[model samples]
Target: MKNIWKILMTITVVAGAALILSTAAFAASDSKTLTINATISARAELVLAPTTINFADNSPTTVSSVSADNPVAVTARVRTGKATAATLTVASANDLTSGSDTIPISAVSWTASGAPFIAGTLNKASAQSGATFGNGSGTYNGTYSFFLANNWTYNTGSYSATVTYTLTAP
Candidate 1:
Protein backbone atom coordinates (compact mmCIF):
# COMPACT_ATOMS: atom_id res chain seq x y z
CA MET A 1 0.00 0.00 0.00
CA LYS A 2 2.80 2.45 0.91
CA ASN A 3 4.63 1.81 -2.39
CA ILE A 4 1.44 2.34 -4.40
CA TRP A 5 0.84 5.63 -2.58
CA LYS A 6 4.33 6.98 -3.63
CA ILE A 7 3.75 6.07 -7.34
CA LEU A 8 0.38 7.87 -7.41
CA MET A 9 1.92 11.07 -5.86
CA THR A 10 4.72 11.08 -8.47
CA ILE A 11 2.18 10.76 -11.27
CA THR A 12 0.10 13.65 -9.90
CA VAL A 13 3.13 16.00 -9.73
CA VAL A 14 4.22 15.17 -13.29
CA ALA A 15 0.73 15.73 -14.67
CA GLY A 16 0.44 19.17 -13.01
CA ALA A 17 3.74 20.32 -14.54
CA ALA A 18 2.64 19.21 -18.01
CA LEU A 19 -0.64 21.13 -17.70
CA ILE A 20 1.20 24.38 -16.74
CA LEU A 21 3.59 24.11 -19.75
CA SER A 22 0.79 23.57 -22.24
CA THR A 23 -1.08 26.68 -20.98
CA ALA A 24 2.01 28.83 -21.54
CA ALA A 25 2.29 28.02 -25.28
CA PHE A 26 2.28 30.52 -28.16
CA ALA A 27 -1.06 30.57 -30.03
CA ALA A 28 -3.20 32.60 -32.50
CA SER A 29 -4.87 34.56 -29.69
CA ASP A 30 -1.52 35.51 -28.08
CA SER A 31 0.10 36.46 -31.42
CA LYS A 32 0.21 40.11 -32.67
CA THR A 33 -1.93 41.43 -35.57
CA LEU A 34 0.07 43.18 -38.34
CA THR A 35 -0.85 45.21 -41.45
CA ILE A 36 0.65 46.57 -44.72
CA ASN A 37 -0.33 48.97 -47.53
CA ALA A 38 0.59 50.38 -51.02
CA THR A 39 -0.14 53.56 -53.00
CA ILE A 40 0.32 55.34 -56.45
CA SER A 41 0.60 58.90 -57.83
CA ALA A 42 0.60 60.74 -61.20
CA ARG A 43 0.52 64.17 -62.92
CA ALA A 44 -1.14 65.77 -65.95
CA GLU A 45 0.74 66.00 -69.30
CA LEU A 46 2.01 69.02 -71.27
CA VAL A 47 0.75 70.13 -74.70
CA LEU A 48 0.95 72.82 -77.47
CA ALA A 49 -1.56 75.46 -78.60
CA PRO A 50 -2.32 77.23 -81.84
CA THR A 51 -1.21 73.61 -81.92
CA THR A 52 -0.12 74.69 -85.36
CA ILE A 53 1.34 77.55 -87.41
CA ASN A 54 0.01 81.09 -87.31
CA PHE A 55 0.86 84.03 -89.52
CA ALA A 56 1.89 87.45 -88.18
CA ASP A 57 -0.75 88.98 -85.96
CA ASN A 58 -2.89 91.34 -88.01
CA SER A 59 -3.06 93.61 -84.94
CA PRO A 60 -0.90 96.71 -84.44
CA THR A 61 1.22 95.06 -87.14
CA THR A 62 1.70 96.38 -90.61
CA VAL A 63 3.12 94.44 -93.56
CA SER A 64 4.25 97.78 -94.98
CA SER A 65 5.00 98.02 -98.71
CA VAL A 66 8.72 98.26 -98.05
CA SER A 67 9.11 98.25 -94.28
CA ALA A 68 11.63 95.86 -92.68
CA ASP A 69 9.70 95.22 -89.40
CA ASN A 70 6.51 94.21 -91.17
CA PRO A 71 3.99 93.16 -88.47
CA VAL A 72 4.78 89.50 -89.16
CA ALA A 73 4.95 88.04 -85.66
CA VAL A 74 3.84 84.38 -85.54
CA THR A 75 2.76 83.10 -82.13
CA ALA A 76 2.40 79.73 -80.33
CA ARG A 77 1.94 78.29 -76.81
CA VAL A 78 2.95 75.35 -74.63
CA ARG A 79 0.14 73.87 -72.61
CA THR A 80 2.23 72.26 -69.88
CA GLY A 81 1.75 69.13 -67.81
CA LYS A 82 4.34 66.59 -66.53
CA ALA A 83 7.09 67.13 -69.15
CA THR A 84 10.11 69.36 -68.63
CA ALA A 85 11.33 70.17 -72.17
CA ALA A 86 10.29 69.82 -75.84
CA THR A 87 11.45 70.68 -79.40
CA LEU A 88 9.42 71.89 -82.40
CA THR A 89 10.23 70.48 -85.86
CA VAL A 90 8.59 71.32 -89.15
CA ALA A 91 6.00 68.58 -89.86
CA SER A 92 7.00 67.77 -93.42
CA ALA A 93 7.95 64.10 -93.62
CA ASN A 94 6.21 62.19 -90.79
CA ASP A 95 4.40 64.81 -88.73
CA LEU A 96 1.01 66.32 -87.82
CA THR A 97 -0.38 69.21 -89.94
CA SER A 98 -1.85 72.61 -89.12
CA GLY A 99 -2.70 75.87 -90.93
CA SER A 100 -4.18 76.69 -94.35
CA ASP A 101 -3.55 79.81 -96.50
CA THR A 102 -1.74 81.21 -99.57
CA ILE A 103 0.95 82.86 -97.40
CA PRO A 104 3.61 80.61 -99.00
CA ILE A 105 3.07 78.08 -96.18
CA SER A 106 2.80 74.34 -96.85
CA ALA A 107 2.75 70.91 -95.35
CA VAL A 108 6.08 71.14 -97.19
CA SER A 109 8.82 72.57 -94.91
CA TRP A 110 8.80 73.95 -91.37
CA THR A 111 10.26 77.41 -90.83
CA ALA A 112 10.61 78.09 -87.03
CA SER A 113 9.07 78.00 -83.55
CA GLY A 114 7.01 80.70 -81.88
CA ALA A 115 6.62 80.49 -78.09
CA PRO A 116 6.29 78.44 -74.82
CA PHE A 117 8.77 76.11 -76.51
CA ILE A 118 6.44 73.09 -76.39
CA ALA A 119 8.73 73.48 -79.20
CA GLY A 120 10.09 76.91 -80.08
CA THR A 121 9.27 79.26 -82.97
CA LEU A 122 11.34 79.90 -86.09
CA ASN A 123 11.17 83.01 -88.26
CA LYS A 124 10.15 83.25 -91.92
CA ALA A 125 11.03 86.91 -92.60
CA SER A 126 12.35 88.03 -89.22
CA ALA A 127 9.29 89.77 -87.78
CA GLN A 128 9.59 90.50 -84.03
CA SER A 129 9.40 88.04 -81.12
CA GLY A 130 11.32 84.97 -82.29
CA ALA A 131 10.60 82.43 -79.53
CA THR A 132 9.64 82.66 -75.86
CA PHE A 133 8.22 80.57 -72.98
CA GLY A 134 5.88 81.12 -70.06
CA ASN A 135 7.66 80.34 -66.80
CA GLY A 136 4.85 79.20 -64.51
CA SER A 137 2.91 77.27 -67.15
CA GLY A 138 5.84 75.86 -69.11
CA THR A 139 4.84 77.74 -72.27
CA TYR A 140 6.90 78.63 -75.41
CA ASN A 141 6.87 81.79 -77.51
CA GLY A 142 9.01 83.32 -80.31
CA THR A 143 9.20 86.20 -82.82
CA TYR A 144 11.64 86.87 -85.67
CA SER A 145 12.51 90.02 -87.63
CA PHE A 146 15.12 90.83 -90.26
CA PHE A 147 15.63 93.84 -92.51
CA LEU A 148 14.41 93.83 -96.12
CA ALA A 149 16.93 96.14 -97.82
CA ASN A 150 14.78 95.90 -100.95
CA ASN A 151 11.03 95.20 -100.46
CA TRP A 152 10.11 95.09 -104.17
CA THR A 153 11.60 91.58 -104.43
CA TYR A 154 8.89 89.66 -102.40
CA ASN A 155 5.81 91.27 -103.92
CA THR A 156 4.60 88.22 -105.81
CA GLY A 157 0.87 88.14 -106.72
CA SER A 158 -0.14 84.99 -104.74
CA TYR A 159 2.00 82.23 -103.17
CA SER A 160 1.35 78.94 -101.29
CA ALA A 161 4.14 77.27 -99.36
CA THR A 162 3.99 74.82 -96.44
CA VAL A 163 5.91 74.96 -93.16
CA THR A 164 6.09 71.93 -90.86
CA TYR A 165 6.75 72.13 -87.12
CA THR A 166 7.74 69.20 -84.90
CA LEU A 167 8.11 68.97 -81.15
CA THR A 168 10.81 66.75 -79.66
CA ALA A 169 11.56 65.60 -76.13
CA PRO A 170 14.09 68.18 -75.00
Candidate 2:
Protein backbone atom coordinates (compact mmCIF):
# COMPACT_ATOMS: atom_id res chain seq x y z
CA MET A 1 0.00 0.00 0.00
CA LYS A 2 2.89 2.50 0.81
CA ASN A 3 4.54 1.80 -2.53
CA ILE A 4 1.26 2.42 -4.39
CA TRP A 5 0.74 5.76 -2.59
CA LYS A 6 4.30 6.91 -3.50
CA ILE A 7 3.71 6.02 -7.21
CA LEU A 8 0.39 7.93 -7.29
CA MET A 9 1.95 11.08 -5.72
CA THR A 10 4.83 11.03 -8.22
CA ILE A 11 2.43 10.63 -11.14
CA THR A 12 0.31 13.57 -9.87
CA VAL A 13 3.35 15.92 -9.56
CA VAL A 14 4.60 14.99 -13.04
CA ALA A 15 1.13 15.54 -14.56
CA GLY A 16 0.85 19.01 -12.85
CA ALA A 17 4.28 20.04 -14.22
CA ALA A 18 3.31 18.84 -17.73
CA LEU A 19 0.02 20.85 -17.61
CA ILE A 20 1.80 24.09 -16.57
CA LEU A 21 4.39 23.71 -19.33
CA SER A 22 1.67 23.06 -21.95
CA THR A 23 -0.24 26.19 -20.85
CA ALA A 24 2.95 28.35 -21.19
CA ALA A 25 3.56 26.98 -24.72
CA PHE A 26 -0.04 27.81 -25.72
CA ALA A 27 0.34 31.39 -24.35
CA ALA A 28 2.45 32.41 -27.39
CA SER A 29 0.56 35.04 -29.40
CA ASP A 30 0.90 36.88 -32.76
CA SER A 31 -0.85 39.95 -34.11
CA LYS A 32 -1.46 41.12 -37.67
CA THR A 33 -1.05 44.83 -38.51
CA LEU A 34 -3.84 46.80 -40.22
CA THR A 35 -3.49 50.13 -42.02
CA ILE A 36 -6.29 52.68 -42.43
CA ASN A 37 -6.63 55.55 -44.91
CA ALA A 38 -9.14 58.33 -45.53
CA THR A 39 -9.46 60.92 -48.22
CA ILE A 40 -10.70 64.53 -47.83
CA SER A 41 -10.96 66.86 -50.79
CA ALA A 42 -11.37 70.58 -51.13
CA ARG A 43 -14.95 71.82 -51.35
CA ALA A 44 -16.86 75.11 -51.56
CA GLU A 45 -20.50 76.07 -51.07
CA LEU A 46 -22.47 79.32 -51.36
CA VAL A 47 -26.01 80.41 -50.59
CA LEU A 48 -27.88 83.60 -51.39
CA ALA A 49 -31.34 84.38 -50.05
CA PRO A 50 -33.98 86.24 -52.08
CA THR A 51 -32.24 85.67 -55.41
CA THR A 52 -34.19 88.53 -56.89
CA ILE A 53 -33.69 92.02 -55.48
CA ASN A 54 -35.89 94.97 -56.32
CA PHE A 55 -34.99 98.64 -56.13
CA ALA A 56 -38.07 100.84 -56.04
CA ASP A 57 -38.14 104.04 -58.00
CA ASN A 58 -37.31 107.19 -56.07
CA SER A 59 -36.87 110.86 -56.86
CA PRO A 60 -33.17 111.53 -57.55
CA THR A 61 -33.38 114.78 -55.60
CA THR A 62 -34.94 113.15 -52.53
CA VAL A 63 -32.71 110.05 -52.47
CA SER A 64 -29.24 110.12 -53.92
CA SER A 65 -29.08 106.32 -53.71
CA VAL A 66 -31.96 103.87 -53.97
CA SER A 67 -31.71 100.84 -51.70
CA ALA A 68 -33.07 97.41 -52.52
CA ASP A 69 -36.21 96.32 -50.69
CA ASN A 70 -34.33 93.64 -48.74
CA PRO A 71 -30.73 92.93 -47.98
CA VAL A 72 -29.32 89.71 -49.44
CA ALA A 73 -28.34 87.05 -46.90
CA VAL A 74 -25.18 85.24 -47.84
CA THR A 75 -23.61 82.02 -46.55
CA ALA A 76 -20.29 80.63 -47.70
CA ARG A 77 -18.67 77.31 -46.78
CA VAL A 78 -15.20 76.25 -47.76
CA ARG A 79 -12.76 73.37 -47.18
CA THR A 80 -9.24 74.44 -47.99
CA GLY A 81 -5.60 74.23 -46.94
CA LYS A 82 -4.48 75.96 -43.74
CA ALA A 83 -2.50 78.52 -45.72
CA THR A 84 -4.88 79.00 -48.63
CA ALA A 85 -7.37 81.83 -49.02
CA ALA A 86 -11.07 81.82 -49.93
CA THR A 87 -12.76 84.58 -51.86
CA LEU A 88 -16.21 85.80 -52.90
CA THR A 89 -16.60 87.83 -56.06
CA VAL A 90 -19.44 89.51 -57.94
CA ALA A 91 -19.68 90.38 -61.64
CA SER A 92 -22.39 91.82 -63.84
CA ALA A 93 -23.30 90.34 -67.21
CA ASN A 94 -23.78 93.80 -68.66
CA ASP A 95 -24.98 97.31 -67.96
CA LEU A 96 -28.62 97.84 -66.95
CA THR A 97 -30.57 98.22 -70.18
CA SER A 98 -34.08 99.30 -71.25
CA GLY A 99 -34.64 99.39 -74.99
CA SER A 100 -32.12 101.94 -76.37
CA ASP A 101 -31.30 103.30 -72.90
CA THR A 102 -28.62 102.00 -70.47
CA ILE A 103 -27.32 102.57 -66.97
CA PRO A 104 -23.76 101.57 -66.11
CA ILE A 105 -23.63 98.54 -63.83
CA SER A 106 -21.06 100.42 -61.76
CA ALA A 107 -23.89 102.63 -60.62
CA VAL A 108 -24.91 99.80 -58.31
CA SER A 109 -22.97 99.10 -55.12
CA TRP A 110 -23.26 97.25 -51.84
CA THR A 111 -22.44 97.56 -48.15
CA ALA A 112 -21.61 94.45 -46.15
CA SER A 113 -22.07 93.54 -42.51
CA GLY A 114 -19.59 90.82 -41.50
CA ALA A 115 -15.94 90.26 -40.87
CA PRO A 116 -13.77 90.20 -44.02
CA PHE A 117 -16.65 91.45 -46.13
CA ILE A 118 -16.15 94.75 -47.94
CA ALA A 119 -18.29 97.36 -49.65
CA GLY A 120 -17.88 97.42 -53.41
CA THR A 121 -19.44 98.68 -56.61
CA LEU A 122 -20.82 96.37 -59.26
CA ASN A 123 -18.57 95.92 -62.26
CA LYS A 124 -19.39 94.68 -65.72
CA ALA A 125 -15.79 94.63 -66.97
CA SER A 126 -14.29 92.68 -64.06
CA ALA A 127 -15.22 90.76 -60.94
CA GLN A 128 -15.25 92.69 -57.69
CA SER A 129 -14.28 91.05 -54.42
CA GLY A 130 -17.08 90.99 -51.87
CA ALA A 131 -15.27 89.03 -49.19
CA THR A 132 -11.85 87.52 -48.50
CA PHE A 133 -11.28 84.78 -45.93
CA GLY A 134 -8.15 83.75 -44.14
CA ASN A 135 -6.79 80.19 -44.21
CA GLY A 136 -8.88 77.12 -43.28
CA SER A 137 -12.23 75.35 -43.44
CA GLY A 138 -15.26 77.19 -42.12
CA THR A 139 -18.71 78.61 -42.73
CA TYR A 140 -19.17 82.36 -43.05
CA ASN A 141 -22.39 84.35 -42.89
CA GLY A 142 -23.13 87.96 -43.88
CA THR A 143 -25.58 90.39 -45.40
CA TYR A 144 -25.25 92.56 -48.47
CA SER A 145 -27.35 95.71 -48.69
CA PHE A 146 -27.39 96.81 -52.30
CA PHE A 147 -28.00 100.28 -53.64
CA LEU A 148 -28.24 102.02 -56.95
CA ALA A 149 -26.85 105.52 -57.35
CA ASN A 150 -29.83 107.69 -58.22
CA ASN A 151 -29.12 110.10 -61.02
CA TRP A 152 -31.45 112.43 -62.89
CA THR A 153 -29.58 111.54 -66.10
CA TYR A 154 -30.73 107.87 -65.94
CA ASN A 155 -33.24 106.78 -68.55
CA THR A 156 -36.92 107.17 -67.61
CA GLY A 157 -37.69 103.54 -68.63
CA SER A 158 -37.14 100.58 -66.32
CA TYR A 159 -33.69 99.01 -66.65
CA SER A 160 -32.46 95.54 -65.63
CA ALA A 161 -29.15 93.67 -65.47
CA THR A 162 -27.96 90.20 -64.48
CA VAL A 163 -25.23 89.75 -61.89
CA THR A 164 -23.44 86.66 -60.63
CA TYR A 165 -21.72 85.88 -57.36
CA THR A 166 -18.89 83.40 -57.19
CA LEU A 167 -17.14 81.73 -54.25
CA THR A 168 -13.71 80.16 -54.55
CA ALA A 169 -11.68 77.99 -52.19
CA PRO A 170 -8.17 76.90 -53.00
**Of the candidates shown, which would achieve the greatest TM-score relative to the real structure?**
2
- Over 1-170, each residue of candidate 2 has an lDDT whose tens digit, in order, gives 99999999999999999999999889678789999999778899999998999889999999999999999999999999888989889989799999989999999999999877888999888999999798998998999999999999987898889889889988
Q: Give the Å shift of residue 25 in candidate 2.
A: 3.7
- Residue 40 in model 1: shift from native, Å? 12
Runs in model 2 deviating more than 4 A are 1-23, 26-34
| TM-score for each candidate, following the candidate numbering | 0.29, 0.82
Candidate whose lDDT is highest: 2
Q: What is the lDDT of residue 71 in candidate 1?
A: 27
Candidate 2: worst 10 consecutive residues by lDDT?
A: 24-33
The digit string of per-residue lDDT tens for model 1 on 76-158 reads: 43444354433344332222222322232221222243444222233454322223333323434454332222232333333
TM-score of model 1 relative to the true fold? 0.29
RMSD of candidates 1 onward, in order:
10.2, 4.3
